[model samples]
Target: MLPINRAVSRGLFAGLALKAGSSTDVAWARACYAIRFQSTSTHLTDASNRIRRRRKKPAFLDRTPFPPSPEEAVNNILYNTPNATPAPVTRHVLNCLVSNEPGVLSHVSGILAGRGFNIESLVVAKTEVPDLSRMTIVLNGQNVVIEQAKKQLEDMVPVWAVLDYTHGRIVERELLLAKVSTVPHEHLSEFVEHEIEGQEVEEPESRTSFSPLLGTALQRQAITELARLFGARVVDVSLDGVILELSAKPDRVDAFLKLLKPYGIVEAARSGAMAMPRSPVDGVFEDEASLEVEDDSGKVDATMLPPG
Candidate 1:
């Protein structure tokens, strides 16, 4: 039997010849058919070579062994890859004391947003002073940019003070509440009560014997112990889960959550970071050198300005 390609070519050329109306056209079709068959083997050879080239291993791969060393394998995988190191940006915490009025939060957030500054966490609430509110904002940015942002915040109409507490000695804390699952593993089987001759028989406790209720109790105990270790309180408990509350520094809170993950955390919520300067002297601003008003008589009244 003729090859499929050759058979199709012969049929195609025969059709062309039959369709030719003139003798010259028929002769031209015959010559074209001869040329096509003559070049078929060369074209097939070139296509086969192309396929083999594509199937061959890349030049870099050929230099490495079948099972490359760990380091070399990693290098090969990451060859010509871009550096994955992140930009140098540090978290900055700013505490702004602003007027307690409507649109204050919106105005403050808008200023940050307009400048392309992302507020990672913002906690705003009424301050000790009745007319003032404190906004604790956490964001990541370069030091210079954060400093400029602080200046802008201080210049706002409603803002009374802007404190950059990122580098200062301050007490920072975050609150976390997590619900952890208390369900026991399915593999634990409860003790089975059997009957023999109408008499109730209980299976004796053994290595294989495990009660789901007991397992659940043990799991709760473990959770309680972990909470105690992390200084977390068991706020609420249910048949299926228990809620834990923790107030600690951000890192400590993260560590506690990491340890609680084994107990199957169902849900979690965090109150963003709240911070205050550790020293009373830190927040106080220096008094201006000149507070006296200049008058035609050059009379100075020290009482005009309040005592610093």
Candidate 2:
């Protein structure tokens, strides 16, 4: 028993001594090396896993209503007009000839604001005759909402005429004024070269003229011709002028200016479009001048329009 107990004690003590030594410098060195090695391996594994997960996840645009396929994403921006369906933002211009009464303008504007039509711009000026005034208003909304707004304006007592300039065969124009920054060689050349981005030229020509594209009775033919011959772009076409914001090549726009030299150019500005539909009836408003409104409740009256 004594021998056995001694053997057990010796073994236990030796094991303890070994364990104690292991916890000191030698054990500490091994422990540190093991931890460092494991840490490096763990980090590398974690990084590889993260890369794989990222590769599997979809892009930000994939969550949209209409996700662009591989082909669409490559060719067009994900948020381009064609890719993104536009909400119903129908634009309209309204031309009115109202009696120059004190509260007439207020009533017209109030009707629009009350019904929640977003008026982009409103201009009111007295006509050549002191008793009458001309008002131009731009607004946007749903087609139904606009129709309701128009009906409300026409129903008002003082409104002589409320013409939806959108359809009228009249000259319409919107002015754009932009004070773009110009620092020497900074963005000046880029800014000077292009204000709006979408421009492509077919052929180069030498020309410098600012001719207002005339919107005459035969303007459709002229526009078609111009588009065919010079590859002129029709930015917008209204009764007034066919807005040709040259998107062709730089040399092409320059050549267009040369071709337009013989024709006179009107005002030019930088920005999006602001146009009004104009008609040749501007000079012959005598019959329209004498138009008398007979209010037929709950119905649109056409006797108010300018006669040709």
TM-scores for the candidates:
0.56, 0.34
lDDT of 2 by residue, 1-308 (tens): 23434444544554555567755455544544445555557668999999998886665675457776989887675456475555677777778878888998788888888988767777787889998988888778877777888888788777788777675554444433211111222333443344356442222243452112222324445444655586545566543345555444334545665554333344444322234453435564434544522233446668987887
Predicted model with the maximum lDDT: 1
Per-candidate local distance difference test: 0.79, 0.58
Pick out the ten consecutive residues of candidate 2 with the lowest summed lDDT: 177-186
Lowest lDDT sum, 10 consecutive residues, model 1, at: 187-196
Best by TM-score: 1
Residue 65 Cα positional deviation in candidate 2, in Å, after optimal superposition: 41
Q: Across residues 11-41, which tens digit of lDDT does each residue of candidate 1 receive?
A: 4675576677545466656755665665677
Model 2 misplacement above 4 A: 1-88, 185-308
For model 1 the local lDDT of residue 194 reads: 22
Off by over 4 Å in 1: 1-87, 185-207, 280-308
